[model samples]
Target: MSNEVRDELLTVYAAMILHSDGAEITSERISKLTAATGAKVEAYWASLFAKLCKNQDLNEILSSCGGGGGGAAPAAAAAAGDAGAGDAGAAPAAAKVEEEEEEEGMDFDLFG
Candidate 1:
């Protein structure tokens, strides 16, 4: 991914982490977090992102991505899910578990 996109995503993840931990979000906080992770974050972008997240409902924003805060982020956190070699193991395992769950039967049938 491009540096711009990476920085943007880093800001988003930092905000999510702070929100999940019930910590206050700030530009300095996001910049520090991303820096500590050894990634270069632009100060301007961090400030802009913090302002963007300031009044927004973090949880609602996260949930809107259809699994951004919960399941998928962790997969991305491992950094394996996005890499090609890791795809073989991660994707199949997830699919197999999902298939098994379907086989066991769901508690409620949405289509019914």
Candidate 2:
């Protein structure tokens, strides 16, 4: 991906993580998160992303981008079934798998 696009995606991912954790999405937070991913981004881009996401509802934006709750049910059901079979850790593992799938889906939606 181009640097611009990559930076934008990193910024968005950082914002999502922050939002999910109920943390404030600030430029400093974006920079830290992007750095945590080991991705180098321009300061201006990071600032721009922070500004853009500050007032936006990320959940709504993601849903508009085809990330609404339509792909998680089966994975959750399977996990629940596994849990019933006595594997207490199955739910977290299943959730990780589902998250990976969702990330892949988001990548396709964003890049295509």
Candidate 3:
């Protein structure tokens, strides 16, 4: 990915980590986190992200992507099912199980 996109995504991820941990999102905190993770980002980007998130509700932002209560799962499942169906010999059930396992293995809790 481009540096701009990577920086943007890392900033969001760091903010989410701080929000989940009930900590304030500050440019210093973001800078420390990004630097620790070895992501090269400009100081302005970290400051900008922290400033934008300061007065914003993370939950509200997430909910706006879809209904906050499990709405994304069905869409993902439907898409996967459709893809599996496109190939006649493909095992939809197995593919779904593998996908679920992969998701279960993901660790979104960056701090712990």
Candidate 4:
């Protein structure tokens, strides 16, 4: 991404982080920011959203895409504590058991 896009993405992400109390970013907010800067930031918003979907909750991502808000944002505080990779939030023993079950029941043709 270009520097301009990166900067814009960070700005929105920062704002999302700042007001992460599940409050929505209203149209008024978008209009005011546009007026002050004359910058249409929606493209950058789209890129930021695409990146967010890779790891964040799908429901939250879809809701944000539908509009500015009307959905819940993840807890910023929870993100602060490291989850130790894909296994971060999982219970060690439970995850191991699931992994074994997955190996026995793997379905490769699901994509084919």
RMSD per candidate (Å) reads: 16.8, 13.8, 13.3, 15.1
Work out the TM-score per prediction: 0.55, 0.53, 0.57, 0.23
Top TM-score model? 3
Q: In model 2, which regions exceed 4 Å deviation? A: 67-112
Best model number under lDDT: 3
Least accurate stretch of 10 residues (summed lDDT) in model 2? 103-112
Model 2 gets an lDDT of: 0.83
**Number of colliding residue pairs in model 4:** 1
* Global local distance difference test of model 1: 0.82
Looking at model 2, residue 21 earns an lDDT score of 96
Clash tally, candidates in order = 0, 0, 0, 1
Greater lDDT among 1 and 4 belongs to: 1
- Candidate 1: the clashing residue pairs are none
Stretches off by above 4 angstroms in model 1 are: 67-112
What TM-score should be assigned to candidate 4? 0.23
Instruction: Give the clashing residue pairs of candidate 3, or none.
Output: none
